[model samples]
Target: MEPKNNEEEWGKTAWEFLTQVRTQSPLIQCITNFVSMDLMANTLLSAGASPAMLHSLPEIPHFTPRADALLINLGTLSPSWLPSFNSAAELCHSLGTPWVLDPVAVSASPFRFNACLELLRFKPAVIRGNASEIIALSMPQHSTTDSTKGADSTHESTDAVEAAKLLAQRTGAIVAVTGATDIVTDGNQVVGARNGVALMQKITATGCSVTALIAAFVAVDKSHALDATVSALAVFGVAGELGMKEAKGPASLRMHLIDALYGLDEAALKSHVNITSLC
Candidate 1:
């Protein structure tokens, strides 16, 4: 399938998902690191999705299948979190609930690097990362540098497209590479969502929060994971673009971004969105 066809199909499906979010608020179980907790939870709420931070082994197993989606972020990996992560992933798989993965700093530590590979065994529905993280996740040998020390990407979004495609092919997951311009793929197709501000990188926790948002969309609309990922990216990026214009800096921009997301509608998307379809 070509990128244009994928974009067209995803576009319609995304709108369907937006309607679903408005009607049925899905509960999202997030076993993410502590760094992104506030931004992620608030973003999910603004987008009409419920979010819970459930990381304990006992709690995660009980909640994983009941929630609409399970989102795991390996930002601050600890040995204690491993059992919970694995058990929740297994429950999601057994219950047929979709899940999203964010390999935050897989390149830095041997523990996180191997842990990410282990997470792949669960077959994530969507994978979200920046350039280096995506590159490292796809081919660890080629990208030895870690991207978790800072939220900013050292590589352009375009540079990671191939890596995203490769990872998607290997895992059968929708891959989202976010940078100056976000590129999302499912091995055979690509959709570029070009509507964010450079200020997005300056803000802390944006990428991790975006990952959680993607999971929320995917949980509500599992039939089209690519569309769910793209919609989440596009909507969040568009909000950033709009929010930066009126805000003073990263601090104010973060608050305004949430307002912008809550303010987003079909009218705003039709005029403000700048995504291009390319295969």
Candidate 2:
């Protein structure tokens, strides 16, 4: 079947996902970095999802089974964090729970790249990252990689569209490449969301928090992983744009972004989302 590019349908779908998330209030287990933990949790709360920062191996089995979804982010890759990530991912897989992987700065170090490769075995429902990390993850030929500058993408989002598609095909996961214009693909169908502002980049952990939001949406409806992922990005992008209008700068933008997300309802999502399918 050919992919349809209907803006109205996209908006309706996004609004539906947003409404489901707000009603469901899914519990998201996040094994994210320290830098992103607080903001990610706040973002989840503002979006009407329960956030649990449980990254200890001892508690992995206990939490993984109860959570709606899991998020593994390699932002602060420490020696102790690896075992917990592996355990949570394995448990989530065995329990048939959806999970997301945010390979932050995966292109920067061999350790991070190798860890991501290992995690791919369990299969994540979604992989959210910048263009550099997605490109590095897609290309297995490269040995010493370098496409990021300390968790920041050095490349444009367009540069990783093909890589994201290939990665999604190989992993059977939705790939979301976030930048000036966010792109989401599930190997066959591609979607683009153009509804964010430059101020988003200045705030730390916006990308990571967005991934957590994706987990929440996916938890609500795992069967439609692509749509859920795209909806999460569209919601975040729309909130960013709305936040920018009231923000003085990066600091204020962060606060306003969270507020905007909290204020976002079905009506706001249906009207503000600028999404289209791209086959």
Over 164-262, each residue of candidate 1 has an lDDT whose tens digit, in order, gives: 999999999999998888899999888888878988877778999999889988987797788788888877887898888889988999999999887
Off by over 4 Å in 1: 1-13, 140-151
Could you tell me every candidate's TM-score relative to the true structure?
0.93, 0.96
Candidates' RMSD to native: 2.3, 1.5
Worst 10 residues of 2 by lDDT: 1-10
Displacement of the residue 120 alpha carbon in candidate 2, Å = 0.4
The prediction achieving the highest lDDT against the true structure is 2
User: What local lDDT does model 2 show for residue 84?
Assistant: 89
TM for candidate 2 is 0.96
